[model samples]
Target: MRSPRRGNAFEQAEAAFKAATKKNEPMPKAPVTPPAGKEMVSLRLDRDVLAHFQDDGPGWQARINAALRAAAGLDPA
Candidate 1:
């Protein structure tokens, strides 16, 4: 097999695991309301905050969401 094809297969497997785990987990029992279809909004945070997130690379947005959830007294995991 080609090298690129092998890399793609590994990526596909990783994605599959993520989806499977997400599906296997029990759903939160908060009356089933979710914040979907929300528009992307920009905010001006402090330089340190921005730097902290940028250093995390990809999925930084998800980290931000988790932080927001925690701030709102909601469970992030």
Candidate 2:
């Protein structure tokens, strides 16, 4: 059965082209050398914990990272 019309012609054509050209590509291998700087990660913190860092407006993330580093007994680099 034909699919119901949704988006405008250009959008529909683009969607069809993407589906037709898609492939089951293998995942890329990890790099041999570790990344030089800090890596992105997701962490869940309590509301109060987040608010405490965000109170200063700017540099909240850096402050949180520093707090974590201090708690881990690492020097603030």
Candidate 3:
């Protein structure tokens, strides 16, 4: 068997570099679709319109969705 390294600055540095370097991590899985069938989206809204929906706080997203559905003449989600 090989003996342990001792007082070897170059060997120590190489080991340190290897330790500090990033290791291969598993690739992240794609985001799953929600059972509710709602897809993630980005929508821009006027500040006042956003504030109006947000004033009640919590479920503001639901309120916005309901309002949009209503405006689109679709049933409330």
Question: Best TM-score goes to which candidate?
Answer: 3
Ranked by lDDT, the better of candidates 2 and 3 is 2
| Candidate 1 global CA lDDT score | 0.79
lDDT of 1 by residue, 4-57 (tens): 454577898998899887755586787755368655788888999977987979
Candidate with the larger lDDT of 1 and 3: 3
| Candidate 3 lDDT over residue span 1-77, tens digit each | 99986759998888899999958898999997765868788999999999999999899999998888898989944
Residue by residue across 1-77, what tens digits does model 2's lDDT show? 99988999999999999999899788999877635787888999999999999999998999998888898989745
Model 1 TM-score (2 dp): 0.46
lDDT of each: 0.79, 0.90, 0.88
Among these predicted structures, which one has the highest lDDT? Answer: 2
Candidate 1 versus truth, CA RMSD in Å, comes to 16.0
Q: Indicate the TM-score of model 3.
A: 0.52
